[model samples]
Target: KVPTWTFHFQRSKRQRDDDALVLPQNQKNPKASRIAYKIEEYNPLLDSSNITPKDWAKIGKDIENNYMDYDGFVILHGTDTMAYTASALSFMCEHLRKPVIITGSQVPIYDVQNDGIENLLVALLIAGTYDIPEVGLYFHDKLYRGNRVTKVDAESFGAFSSPNLAPLVSTGVNITVNWNIVWRDKYQQRFQVSTEMNQNVGLLRLFPGITATTVRAFLQPPIEGVILETYGSGNAPDKDKALLDALKEATDSGVIIVNCTQCLRGTVSLTYATGAALKKAGVLPGADMTPEAALTKLSYVLAKKDLTLEEKKWVLFKNLRGEMTDAAGEPKLCLSDSRFIQAIAKSLSLSCTEELGAVRDALTPSLACAAAKTGDIEALEALKQLGSHLFFGDYDGRTPLHVACCEGNLNAVQYLLSQGATVHAKDRYGATPLSNAVHFRHKEVVELLRETGAHLSRDELDEAGVELCSLAASGDLEGLKLWILAGADLTKPGPDGQNVLQVAQSAGQKEVVATFSSCS
Candidate 1:
């Protein structure tokens, strides 16, 4: 049982008129007893578009003022920019340990067929009953992290969706709460609010034939941050030197430019030459973040006057408020040595020094690298806990990630990333994890590495061609295609001084032989 308060912004699309009170004040019914709750509404509502950073400050202040009075809060907002408001509130409200559910509907409660009533009812129920303390958007039948959600359909009942992350709760016959995925504070810190949000940010979308003049004009004075929406996988035209120069100039002027992909599903990857150019020009990768999250996050980050510009850029790429997926998974401990596994499970400190010594006596750097390549999460965790150095290179200068990428161990790759493995680490032959993933046709691993800002130079690509030729010999059409699309030189000879077609034929890869024959 919990006491509930509703703060209405009066931005519902279903409202017949723009009034302060959408419903009767302090209205309660028999349904209140069933849910074991009491409801109260506040005043001075405004449209969602009119809800700015100042208004966000007001909301935070109100919540802080009445922090102890209620267990949870619900905000009524407009769907037109509900995502923006939600994203803004997620950043503005800091260290919040109580649910702040924002909800609205396509139709008004007065309509014969309206969703507002249900949305409000469910939001109230979840706010009061559930222990979900983060800011969330309750729409259609799902509860999404406030900053992760985007309003997808203007006409459909399911108006919102969280593309990059899973929902906190899915409402069907039974309200299924995914406890594992829900964000929680382990230490239960006191709630705080951030009132200052810099609005001097803008978004520039790239398209075919977009000129340098347009880019330069948009990035002119007054804009401190810009979200540059690029083509698939965060690519722009490398041939467009003028566009690249304008970006470089903006970054040189201390403008924080974030390179995000226009594609909704995947993240912005810096694998291609064009994406590498953007990175060289100092554009930070906005990995899998929706434009709404990117824009609001940039505003929040820029508003932190205490932080340096470099620090702000660092925070921009990190996952804050469950807004974006940082990596796929955490490191798991899997070791044949029960003692080492137990030591890691007990604690990650030096108390396991004895067990670590035993393990280190048997585990060489190459063996540890083999464990990483084989996706031995437990072994990696144990090794890390035992204070094993991660930067040790194999004979070929390949790191654990390089081997994991070649083996297509996405979990190992993600776990390695979480442990601060360098993404752009190069081998003796200059092959990166991305190049290794490409060579092995590990599409998912390639994307993950790219999302982490791994890039290859033209020379590095040429060096990786030897590995790609192996894929061609094995009849790996997908790998061959990816390399071709990435402008790999197919004319290069393999180690045996034979072309890719000759290698394919010798390896009995008829399909690959036919593909090369047809191309020739």
Candidate 2:
């Protein structure tokens, strides 16, 4: 299904050791013959660290020169500084419409147990077949956006991770591509290469007891940009007047200072007084961009000879090339609508369904229960359209509505009730959906059920109390709290004649026991 042309860059540690060229023909296990491709290895391979702005230009030129000839490009690179190269290339190749997969392995290809061959094979397949027209790193069975990846391991095959963004594709028995999250340009643009990256940018990480002299020296002249890796959420020492003055001096002189969080997961927020001080010092928030993306982007923006320093700073905050996420710009969801239909389809493994008949047959009782548990109206509608019985119950006599109430899926309970689902369906334990909702302490679900004239008789209330005691014994603190709020009788004995406190104590649920004691 795919053709391949392999280009080797002579910068990886494995390649430097002269181990990558030793093919399996000379090895004891020659079974590597099954892995086939139309290979074209280029000359003058350079190590990744030796790669610079000029090398990035050369790679971009090569891809642009051959853009019309090949469907995709596969680059074999060293793991060290691979993220840097990936980030740089992502900016250089503008309006890219063909896959540019960068991949490498911890072990050399010469080793029989090496991961190199598989990584190469998968990269080739992804580039050739998939329409992922962007720079990506395919390592260990996961394909990550080039700008979002970081190498976290040195000895294992699964060495790279993308903390902020999810993987573009995951390869296993079936290649699972998460189409929803894949970055796609709204309008097609002409492919062009921009290799002129200014090498004057630098990265400065703040440490404990870091002096102002050190910060000032790092942001000195000729460094047009500096990525200041600040404390959690981009906070630095506000009390350190010397450090603040140094940062102010850098910005006063027109040097762009971008504040990024030193921590891996969160974004930079200027809500804290200390963080707000940094903003006052002319340090722009880098949002949630990784250190790699921040540094490379700074270099790319600074190289724009046509733009002024202020213009470059303005462009840095913009989401160019999908490098940063604007957290405040996300839209709010309305629960009454079909906002969760796609998610329901994904959870039900129905994303690949092409026909309505297929959608109908796939809506098994288990699937219906799953959809109900999540309160997916779109999925339920699809099932109902396919002639699925809305009152369908599982082996335990628990219908879709019953499971929805137990899981506190208020939206699902409301939708099922509107769709004529029986309000008083009982499970094998003689527990109705209302009793289940009460036992679980699902306040929203209980309220919604009660509004629909769903009620529990005295016997049902007694059974629900027993279920609440069992939940207490299992250390379900939230469930116990909810049950109590719903007027569940804590004094009611469980099936074993133990009160809620006694059952919780016997099961070593100390927190539940404490909660029960507090309630009493």
Candidate 3:
């Protein structure tokens, strides 16, 4: 069991054996400064020392009944069953209007160097102040809604993450809230407590040789609901009729069986034969909903008094609290390695400018040129598949060669030069590849461009002044050195009326400033 507030309270009681244990004196509520608040100390469910689960429930009921007496409730519990408790209370507390932030630390609270104090303090602050009515788990300084969370790691300090969902609050020096992502139940405002959970809900994991006997046990008379975790995209063998029949019987008998994926990314649809078989067998596809969300939601719906069985089944598959996404008509973009499959798959490619880049007719020579221009090696490879000759011009009328030189892509510049690119090819502005190479301080590319007999006239030096000064202004020392060595007339003033050295000095390039000092 996880060490909680009771552990600390017990220790305090032991140290001061004579006096009745009292909580730290009341502190001012951080939310509405007018209100003063006191901590409500209670025994945790996992406290084998004195309290049982019933005792803990009684305490929870007391707080839920008399919630107006206090601003919020803070619970410290063992991490093992914290989710169960949080999920139970989410249904038990009906229209909750105040924060009931549950938190636990891996280390004991009494430890001098522990995360407990900070977590407790922050949870208390949020609970006492924020109008968060839903149950939430605060761990490692991040606040996540109780239902959407899973304990991903057991030993790490950062043990929990809401993978399919965004965290409600992220903590640094200040707790930054993603208010747009918070979950609110408009229908749940008028609080109603429903705690009767169908404990017979079966959680079945699909694995190799998962036979009739394995699934048969879960579909037995006792179980009322089932959360079936299926293989990629909710597929099961059509050959398995026994499992199919069992599911069909359960669903026909008013049992709610939800189908979720074992994978972290992607969702299931009733498109394929295998998925359709399960759907026909009365298994509802929980599109993109985590197993935790599905289980609790089923528990919630099963406990509701008003909804009929059909209504409950409909609600299970539909979006509630942003847990599941509505289906899109077209199949989702897949990244599977299967060629025989009719799935849509696209590779991720990033350009040098951090834009998501895509290639049209990816295996074409022209696509290679486009990739070279954007400095995307993957796209370049795809482009090479079509033909040897590849070339693309940017908006500036600069070819792949010009972009390569400017961006210091030595390999791309070399490849372009090797591919019969004219050494003296000038851009729309009449600036050659060597001019860009020198201006960008790509010495190696500049050397190669010069080896290809790249030329720049004395008149071109005047035009080069504007581009060279821009590089210098950005403290590009390498570009400045290349231009100076490549016969760029530093003595010439730029169109901006500032020389390279003046640009460097004004931009705080002390080394470039010193280098240009000698030239001036």
Report, for all candidates in order, the number of backbone clashes.
5, 3, 3
- Candidate 3: deviation at residue 139, Å? 0.6
Question: How does each model score on TM-score?
Answer: 0.59, 0.60, 0.54
- What is each predicted model's overall lDDT from 0 to 1? 0.74, 0.74, 0.63
Candidate 3 weakest ten by summed lDDT: 6-15
Q: What does candidate 1's lDDT look like per residue over 130-236, in tens digits?
A: 65768899999899999888888988889998888889998876787765467643332346788899999998999999999999999888989999999999999
Query: Tens-digit lDDT track for model 3 on 25-87?
Result: 334422223223343455333542343335445545765564533445777766766655665
Ranking by lDDT: 2, 1, 3
Candidate 1 wrongly placed segments (more than 4 Å): 1-43, 186-188, 333-520
**Candidate 1, residue 121: lDDT:** 76
Predictions ranked by TM-score, top down? 2, 1, 3
Task: Give residue 1's lDDT in candidate 3 (0 to 100).
Answer: 42
In model 1, what lDDT does residue 354 have? 60
Best by TM-score: 2
